[model samples]
Each structure stands twice: as C-alpha cells, then as structure tokens.
Target: MELIKLGERTFCADGPFKVGVYILKEADGYSEVCIIDTGVDEAAAREIDEALVKAGFRVSLILNTHYHADHSGGNRYFIEKYGCKAYSQKINAAMISNYDICPSVVWGGNPVKEVLNNYFYAPPCEAYDISELEMPEGLSIIEIPGHCIEMFAVKTADEVYFLGDGVVSVDTLKGHKLIYVYDIDKQLESLELMKGLKGKVFVPYHGGITEDISKLAEANISVMKENIELILDICTTPKCLDDIISEVFDRYGYKLTMYKYAVEGGVIRAYVTYLYNKGELVAVKEDNYIRWKKA
Candidate 1:
C-alpha cells in the first residue's frame, strides 16, 4: 500500500513497522524526507521507499525511536541504500550496533510459554552502523528504562505520544488482570509521567493506539500496584533470581519458561531495588539465599 497519510507531512505504513511509519514529506524533493521507525526487513524497507516514491516524497533522514530490532532493523539497509543518516538514543548505540547482542533471547520470555507454546522466530537484525544524530523537533524522548536499558517514546505535534512500550494500549489491557512489565516500578513511574500528559491520544507500537491516555494510565497503575502487593505477599522467603522469577510468574498463572524469554536480570533486581528504595521491604544476605522481609 501507498502512504497511510496521517497529516499534511505525516504517513504510516503497516506489516513492516507494525503500526506504520511517520513520514515528513519533503518540500524540496524525495531526497529531503525524514522517516521515523523503519519496519522489520529489506522487503519492508523497499516498500517504505516505494511508497514514498509513489507519494513523491524523497527519503533522506531516518530516526529510530529506540534500538529494538523491530524498530531499527531496517536502519542499515536504509543508510546503505539511500545514504540517509540513521539515528537512535545515545545510550543504546553500542547495544544495537554491536554484533554480539543476540536479541533472540528476549522472546518466549517466560518459561511457561516456552514449554506450552513453540512460537519462535529468528532474530531479524544484524548490527546497523548508523551515524547518530540528535532527536528532531516534535520528537522529544524520555528515558523509560524498564522495557530495556534505553527505552523512550516519541511525541508528535498532533498531541499523539508514540509511546513504544512504556505502556500498552487500553484495548489490550481490558482482558488481562495482570500486566507483565519487567521493571514494574520504572514502568509505573513512566506511566506516572504519562498520566500528566495533556495529549488526547497515545500511539503505542505493539497493541495499537489509544485515546485519552490519562484513563489508560490510571487503569494500568491501579492494576500494577495491586500486582506488586500480591507478589510481595507471596515472597515468604528470598530465592535466587530465577526462583523469584519463577515464583512470580507461576502466581500469575504464567510459566516462567514461555512466551517471552529475556526478563531483565538487572531489572528484576530493580523490582526488589524499587521496594527497597520505597522503604516497604528489606533485603538481608543469607548464606545461600538472600532473604527479603517486608518492613
């Protein structure tokens, strides 16, 4: 399909990028265009350009909303083919560009889903060597470290906050009683920042967009706070990282070994860290296992 125009200079594409692309239509020609979030592979990359060609917009600069493979996967292809500059958050530069970062571990992140479900896919990206640039106008980023080390959201002029995964859409939130945010506290804080937003709409990449983001923010916060309390209650003894993880997952009726795999070790530690930071819990070093006692 051609451009799914959202505004005078903006458009969105599907399948590749999932939700779509944000096109800054070039006034000069096709060469001056700015695109935010290139979709998955070479095929998606080509379609983005082809659609631009059809719309008479030239591709010039490409900005990755974050370093996730799904968002920046096409950066290398775009820069190599179009000579467009590639950009991402300064913090994630090494992780996304290094060849050693095998992101496949992030999927089927829970062991329960890993055993019950066999859904898997190859890691679709290689290192993308983008000459980084600062974020552009109408695209301010706030560090949301829970989802990953360097997660952020891109806000547009339309009062639409293109939050990557800081929060899921309300539609997806409707059925699930518990939401699996790796860093529950930071995710909560991120949602807090979003709660203050005057923006009437939110466009998260994964589960589609939402309107009146304040409402979704409220629901997510309420449910998550309750989950945290429940997890704390279940912690009769301090267990190893994996044991705690498994315990928490099983409580939610989730198999820790399935669906998704890479739950952040540092972030998991951060969950306890958050509780400690909040003065609600205390951690004591035991000989073999760390004992966490609620204060």
Candidate 2:
C-alpha cells in the first residue's frame, strides 16, 4: 500500500481499509509516526511497516479507534516490533488485551471454532485507556461510538479527521445494504455529529477521503432508516428473530455463512432492539417462541 499525503503531517496508507499515519516528530534522525489504526492482520501491519520504513519513519504509538479485528488486528505486531504504546477507550482496551471477547460477544456465547479466525479474533495486545494516556501533540479524540463500543475519531493537527467507521461509503451501504452497528440510536447521533465536524479532510476507514462528509453522513443515515423500515415491514405479521434474520438475508441476497450469520445477524438484532424500544414493535411470547410484530 502507498502512503498518500493528506496534510503537512498526515498521511493515509490507502488499502482495502485505510490506515492513518501521522508524523508526530523527527527523533534520532527518523520520523516518529503515530498510527491511527492498524489494518486487518500481521500481513497488513507488515506492509504498513515496510511502507513507513521505506519512507524513513518508525512507529512509536498506535491509537486504536476500537477493538474490532479489522481495525486493531495488527496491534500486537506493531507493539512487539517497535515497542510502541497502544491506547484506546477503556472498554476497547480491555477487549484488545483479550480479543476472545469479540467473537464471543458476536456469537452471544462461547464462539465455535469456525468463527475464531483473525476476522473475529484479533491477536491480543496490551493497550492502555486513551483517557489516561497523554496524547501526542496535535492529536485529539472525538467520541463517535455506535459502529462499535467506545469508538473514537481522531482529529490531527492538520484538521484531518480519521473517522473510524463512523460513516461508510455509499458503495459500502449499497453492497451490504446494512452495516453492523452496536447501538442504532448512538449510530444516528454519530452520523449527525459527523456532519457538524470541521475538518480539511475526513477519512473513514471504509470510505475514501473527502473534504466534505455531509453527503456520506446523510447516505449512512438514510440506509439506517431504510433498514429499520424494512425490519418493521417484516414484523407486520409477527415473526421470530430467526425468521426476521432469514427474511432480511433473502431480501438483501446475503450468502449465509457462519461469519455473516453472526455479524449481519447482529445488525438486524440492533435494528429490532431500536424499533422495539421506540414502541414501533412489540414482543410476544407464543408457542414457546418470542416473536415481534408491528405495534
């Protein structure tokens, strides 16, 4: 991957998932870099390391947006290799230190062996709570929790905001129809927050860099509303959680795998919870099954 310069000190290693590289200082004749988020795996981290080394930079710190494998999978690699410090929100730091929590939470219990791969379980690494750490000069954290618990967007001194999946590209929405979210209400609030953020450029991990994020934020908000409506429509006749998930998969043409069942299924459940809490949907227990129906 190539590091594309965004500002005087900000650069993004553009790949399937963008990794933010910010030059903190030049020390010992090498540029000291603070990585916003490491990519999916060791391989991704290795590529980033090579790119940074080629450019005469050394990683001194990693600021994880959240504990998702795709975002923090390379944490151990960087910390072990460079002796770099890693930090995240308290809850995320705990998860990053013990990554099995990820797949277990997604599966709602002890995860089966099939779901224990890198995508679900990141290699564990020690990470301190960002709140307790002294942030490097020019780096600031913005709380944008929703996509994941305690996710934060980093704003560089150059006014470049590294949005950690707070908003997805329109194409990502079109491809997946529904993105994974921990809390629907928080996700919507974060979308509104993204619109009001002032930045020279905003970089979403999934979405490419853009000067303005209004359209992208609106698109994400629209898809979330649409997904909610779709769920409400499906529940009109009353359906069990499994039935709703099956119908959603059919409507979205999602290929069912163990992984998608956990991830996408979780997204549907979040929408269901949002609607139920809003009093638009009601839960009924009948014939040994709990079903949801339009209220």
C-alpha-based local distance difference test score of model 1: 0.58
Best by TM-score: 2
**Per-residue C-alpha lDDT of model 1 across residues 73-97, encoded as one tens digit per residue:** 6666777877777665664555556
Go through the candidates in order and give each one's C-alpha lDDT: 0.58, 0.89
**Residue 126 displacement in candidate 1 (angstroms):** 11
* Regions of model 2 farther than 4 Å from truth: none
Model 1, residue 160: C-alpha shift (Å): 3.0
**In candidate 2, what are the lDDT values of residues 1-295, reduced to their tens digit?**
7888999999998887899999999988799999999998999999988889888899999999998888999888899999988999999999999997988877778877777877668768888999888988999999999988789999999999999889888778888876889899999999999998988999999765788888889888999998998999999999999899999999888877777778788888988988999999999999999999999
Error of 1 at 106 (Å): 6.6
